[model samples]
Target: MQNTTWGAIMGQPFGVIGYSNLGFVFDRDRIHEYQTYWPKEETGLARDVYIGFKYQCVEYARRFLTLKFKAAFTDIPHAHNIWALDIIEDCTKEEGTFPFVNYPNGSKEPPQFGDLIIYPYSKEQRFGHVGVILNVNLEEKYVDIGEQNYEEAGWECPEYARRLIMKIENGQYFITNKRIGKPYDNWDINEEIFGWKRIDFSQKQ
Candidate 1:
């Protein structure tokens, strides 16, 4: 297992780390930046669709969908609220929406690449958390995810922020925040993962 301990270099701007896969940058968010009001001038958008805060976890997730999958979702109150969504806006299609399926934690279905990993509200994460799965390696029993505002550490791998353990038991897939028996996730793993949400493009046609 790679050392979980991260070193922050001095003079880094707002704890900004480099980009995680797909040209989406992740940051440390050291100032605890929060803006209760969304100004049209400050809101980040792609193709005129809202993409949440500048460096929040939700921002990265939405940006991933926009740039990679040509998908969009309307404003959500919190990151955890994403799980309740039933459809995703098809940015490339006019007046179109695509079905989004949720696979709760310990479900029979395993998470796939491009799925959005959602976390429930916990004491540590008041608004909850969200991340995009970059890869799922069943053979290696690990899942690599990319996100922001979760950890200050630089990428453990070139394309991912961190890796989590995955195991299958009795045909059900389960995820643990730990990477190879050691705690690698920064949040409280006890809250457990709510599950993953995927845009079912197969339903579009």
Candidate 2:
């Protein structure tokens, strides 16, 4: 029999691995279901939900990396390591500018297993969004990360294929937006067991 604690999410494209409880093929191999907070529908409720999910997803992604890569993982050691949303926001911590702390840049050292991915909403470099590098390859420049409400949700846009398109010729990693088609039981649930942490961090205090 199959695992049935929760059901795979529906209405989206991709499968949920009941084992990990992560939503898949959104913009990466996996993204936190918390993203439901700021859905493409862009409803007021969605935005409100995003406020809490961002931070939780941040920690979740970090934990996921640590668990998946084990010895091959590098950590982001700052509470503010997440996206600034507003550039003027504080980034005073020494670690704020440190490696793997903030970036679209990959760590040149060991645990080079992944790179940092940033989605810039505004023209300025200090805001918008951030995500971790999931995978990369020279022949196929594709990146997979935990992301939400991708601007294109995997479509073609000016200068490049927005959303899920992986770089074919440049860049150090292979990043791609998740493509959605007919989904198979998309609902995914976690944290109901009581010991799970309810993460909340869309904006730092």
Best by the TM-score measure: 1
- Count clashing pairs, candidate 1: 0
Minimum summed lDDT over a 10-residue window in model 1 is located at 7-16
Scored by Cα lDDT, where does model 1 land?
A: 0.71
TM-score of each: 0.75, 0.32
Task: Residues 88-112, candidate 2: write the lDDT tens digits.
Answer: 1112221211222332323222112
Location of the lowest summed lDDT over 10 successive residues in candidate 2: 189-198
For each candidate, the alpha-carbon lDDT, in order, equals 0.71, 0.29
Residue 42, model 2: lDDT of 49
